[model samples]
Target chain A: MSKEKIRELKKKIEALVIAIPRELEAYEFYLDLAEKSADDAPSKEMFMFLAKQELFHRDHLEKMMNDLQSQLEEELKKGK
Target chain B: MLPLKKLIVHTHHIATHFTNALFPVSAALITLYLITDKPSFETACYYSMIFGLMSIPVAYGSGFYDWRTRFQGRRTFIFDHKVVFGIIFLILASIVVIWRSYDGGIMYSVGLNKWLYVTLVYSLTGIATWLGYLGGKFI
Candidate 1:
């Protein structure tokens, strides 16, 4: 791959690095809400659902990141 | 410079422009959602906003990198406004995303919250325009 392409990949990885934490934070926020609303069964269930959704998001993002990282490494090795 | 740092310095414009482009699409999508009352439009708008939210940090990070490297970290008026407003835009976008996530029916609901959600989505376009204008001035 060309240098420009490598740079683009790096930029994408940087974005994922920033985004992953946000998904985790969202997960934590909902988890905390879920715990607090234990007595309110419906609200607690809703919060747990949201928390799971966030975890799913995080997992999806992490998969993307991993795919990108492997591609970046492969390209770097080819360049070398 | 290292490849990573070089990318940060050279790609701020690309990052910022990409982010600016996404917000308008998001704004328009949300407006269409309200007008047509279509669930798909709302879903598209939500995805656009999520994409926009993710890209903002990339833009903000690259802009900071460019400022520190190219401009010697000067605190000029335009830069100051961009930094402050950039942060504000991020916060507003996050609120809309989180609120919608918590309540899927927010857009359909009839209340101050629904209007507020719409207002926030529209405000994204205004903020993005201002940021783009300021960015142009910087160059």
Candidate 2:
């Protein structure tokens, strides 16, 4: 691949990495909402349900980052 | 830097909007139950509640799982919003269960407890909505 293409891929990987932290924050937010509703049964169940999704997204992103790192390393090796 | 900033700006703007929508979606589902007074509505609420609660539990679990399995330490942050929001949702859920029980079939019976639960549902929904705002900032 050309230098330009490799550089663009690197930028994309970096952006994906940055996004992981925000996803974590969103997950925590759902958790907080669920906790607050513990006094009420209905809301508690719902919030907990939604909170799990946030965690799923976080896991999804983390996996994406790991994959990206491996891909970047492989590409660099090809350039050698 | 400039393009990244623009992307973040756009993303935040969209997230705030999406989070805001959760309130009305939940409220509308609840209102449908209140208005129609049917068992189906009750089922709908049940589904929503179940889905909502799963989000938090799964998120926390996955976060820990990632940390332990990946050996990466990038999932910690300001947790005030999470703690408060979790408590609020729990309180609301309790009120909902009681309200569900209060009514014979679906809608609440004409009683003091009905009114009390209604008031709580409204209050807790408001809290949930605000927490969405805080979440948007962090996201």
Candidate 1 Cα misplacement greater than 4 A, ranges: A1-80, B1-5
Chain B TM-score for candidate 1: 0.92
Give per-residue CA lDDT, model 2, range B21-134, as digits (tens).
Answer: 544455666677788876676556545544554453443444334334333443323234545564666667555655564554434457676566556556656766776654
* Per-model DockQ against the true two-chain complex: 0.01, 0.03
User: Where is the poorest 10-residue window by lDDT in model 2 chain A?
Assistant: A12-21
TM-score of candidate 2 versus the correct structure, residues matched by position: 0.40
Error of 1 at B6 (Å): 4.0
Q: Give residue A11's lDDT in candidate 2 (0 to 100).
A: 68
Q: Report the Cα lDDT for residue B55, model 1.
A: 80
Query: Chain B alone, TM-score of each model?
Result: 0.92, 0.53
**Residues forming the 10-long window of minimal summed lDDT in candidate 2 chain B:** B69-78
